[model samples]
Target: MPHLTIVANIKANADKVDLVKSELLKLIDPTVAEPGCVQYDLHQDNDDPAHFLFYENWESRELWQMHSNSNHVKALAAATEDAIEELSIYEMTKVH
Candidate 1:
């Protein structure tokens, strides 16, 4: 299976960013155990606290689709709406 990479960038108001980070961390275990998930990790930029990224590896595109519609992700969206100033998601495959 091919690897998947998700780049999630966000800008939040003050501590709201931390709140979003906390919520995102809550998703780690469930995300890792999902059907096609091979690995899942979340990272924060040291120089820019407002920047965050979620690195995920999936068995296939199908599994990613399932993850997008899952209840856990939905809950995360709900929890983060108030905290997010801007959010962008990039889905791509590794070139090397």
Candidate 2:
């Protein structure tokens, strides 16, 4: 099966950046342990502390979907509902 590359872009409300970061951090360890998760990395924009991104690689889309529906992700979504200014997820495939 082909792998997937996921890029999640998140923007937190200026005053809520810390809260958003905390909630997102909660997903790291668990997500990395999920089956088929090749990589899961988080990054904060230096020029804009409120902007954050996740660079992830999954062994398959099915596993990625499972991860998306996991409880930890649900909790993060709920926790940041009000604190997030913008959220977007992109799924990609690399070409040789």
Candidate 3:
């Protein structure tokens, strides 16, 4: 497993920013503790309100896939479908 960070840029700044932010917070604990996941965090950019970053640390790529297939993940996606313009995921490992 490695560390994963996902950044998503929303399509449009919406009225539900607070709601979406809350939803993201709700998913953090469960997602981080999920199999293979070491940590999961959500970040908001004050300079760009439409930009969100998800910081995730996983045990392995395989387990990450399992999380991606989870129901909550789906719900998150569905909840933000209209707001997302693009999504990017980065994989990294500690060298130190």
Candidate 4:
């Protein structure tokens, strides 16, 4: 089966950009160390600092789901509650 790819975009409230960024940064190391994580990368939009994106690849959708439900992910939700403006997630399979 093809690997699962996730594209997550996070938009933070103007006043909370730094806070949201810090919380998002906390996910990298832990996520990269997870069982099925193939790649996990985070990026910030140079033109819009409040916008952040995560590009991730997992061995399978099930493993990615497990990672989403992990304690660290929950913590991120809690820590950034009310600080985010919008969140979008896309799950995909590589075509090539």
Candidate 5:
């Protein structure tokens, strides 16, 4: 199976930036330790503090799908339902 890359762009409510960050940060350790997870790093926009990004590389599409529906991920989704302003997921494969 080919490697998969995921770029997740998340925007936090301006007034809930801190709360959002705390919630997202909680997933890092577990996500990184999951099987097939090559890299899972989180980033905050330099100019726009409320904007966040997740750079993740997985071994395959199946593994990524599993990760997406994992307990922790589901918990995060429920926990931050109202705190998130925008959530976009991009799944890609390298061409070159």
Candidate 6:
């Protein structure tokens, strides 16, 4: 089976960029240590500090789902509830 790839785009509220970023940063360490996690990387747009993106690879969609429902992820959601302007997540498999 093909590995799962996740592309998450996050846009922070104008005044909450720093808070959102810090909360997002908290996910990396724990997520990387989760089962089936192959890669977990986070990035901020060079021209737009309020924009952030996450590139992730998982061994399977099921395992990724587990990670998604973990406590840490939930905390992130709660912490940034009102601080985020937009959030988009795309689940895909590599074609090449």
RMSD of each predicted structure? 1.4, 0.8, 2.6, 0.5, 0.9, 0.6
Model 6, 54-92: lDDT tens per residue? 999999999999999999999999999999999999999
**Steric clashes per prediction:** 0, 0, 3, 0, 0, 0
Instruction: Give per-residue CA lDDT, model 4, range 1-96, as digits (tens).
Output: 899999999999999999999999999999999999999999999999999999999999999999999999999999999999999999998998
- Per-residue lDDT value at 5 in model 4: 96
Where's the lowest-lDDT run of ten residues in candidate 3?
Answer: 4-13
TM-score of each: 0.88, 0.96, 0.76, 0.98, 0.95, 0.98
Rank by lDDT, highest first. 6, 4, 2, 5, 1, 3
The alpha-carbon lDDT assigned to residue 6 of candidate 2 equals 98
In the range 1-96, model 5's lDDT, one tens digit per residue, is: 568999999999999899889999999998999999999999999999999999999999989999999999999999898999999999999787
For candidate 1, write residues 24-94 as lDDT tens digits: 88889888888988878788889888777777777777888899899999999898878888888788898
State which candidate, 2 or 6, has the greater TM-score: 6
- In candidate 2, which residue pairs clash? none
Residue 64, candidate 1: Cα error in Å is 0.5
The better candidate by TM-score, 2 or 4, is: 4
Task: Give the residue spans of candidate 3 off by over 4 A.
Answer: 1-16
- For all candidates in order, the CA lDDT equals 0.82, 0.96, 0.70, 0.97, 0.94, 0.97
lDDT, residue 75, candidate 2: 93
Q: Could you give me the TM-score of model 2 versus the true structure?
A: 0.96
Q: Evaluate residue 62 in candidate 4 and report its C-alpha lDDT on the 0 to 100 scale.
A: 92
Q: For model 1, what is the alpha-carbon lDDT of residue 8?
A: 66
